[model samples]
Target: MIPPRFAVTEDQIAAVVAEFYTCVRQHPGLGPVFAAHVQDWPAHEAKITRFWKNAILFDRGYDGNPLAVHRAAGDVRIPMFDVWLGLFDSVLRRELPSETAAAWSALVHRIGRGLVFGLGQAEGAPPSLR
Candidate 1:
């Protein structure tokens, strides 16, 4: 039998993104790193909301090169991915149903690993030392 697919809506995605960022902004380690790059929370949240809509719904609303942006940031480290994913998992699980949370978690993990690989830090080397 085929597994049941969760119908993820825009509202759900928006809520998840908002709550996830709230946690990120309050996080001890990840908060400072994000603040250094994202000066405007409202704009950043809007962009990320579009990003998630496009990613999860194929809405074609987002067009930014996330890998390039992260690479240009120049200060992101390998371990930071761990923190980001951990917080993301926490928020998603808390705010969404299990099926939705699992789906988003899988996609986010794939994206995070790809970003780490693109940053040349997949082998656990910090970007600052690379």
Candidate 2:
């Protein structure tokens, strides 16, 4: 039998991206923001594919700035970040096994919070570092 790998494969990345967007589209807090900002989803889909693929694979394929993309998307309100995180966590929990799911859950939460808080800081907002 083959050992389970810690790394997320290309197919897994694709699935995650697709699931993520689907969840985002359905999430009440995040749906409108997504619909408004994500006008061209195919390109965004490819970009997220590259992003997660590189993030998990340590490859050099991803080049887009997530921070910049979110910044350009002025539709995201303060509560949307938490809502997005919840949806992401929900999707992850539903898809992965317990151990792998836990790891990815922690990773996504940490990274999502960091990104949102960092963006807040950069925008001269009050500290969102919680």
- Cα lDDT tens digits, model 1, 1-130, are 3322356888888888899989988999988889999999989999999998777777777989888888778788878998899999998999888988998899999999888887774434566543
lDDT of 2 by residue, 1-130 (tens): 3333354567766887789998788877677777887788888888888887666666668988787677777765556777777788787777767776677777777778777776666575677436
Residue 39, candidate 1: alpha-carbon lDDT: 93
Best of the candidates, TM-score: 1
Give the range where candidate 1 is weakest over 10 consecutive residues by summed lDDT. Answer: 121-130
TM-score of 2: 0.82
Estimate the overall C-alpha local distance difference test score of candidate 1.
0.85
Query: lDDT of each structure?
Result: 0.85, 0.74
Alpha-carbon error at 61 in model 2, in Å? 1.1
Clashes (candidate 1): 0
TM, every model: 0.86, 0.82
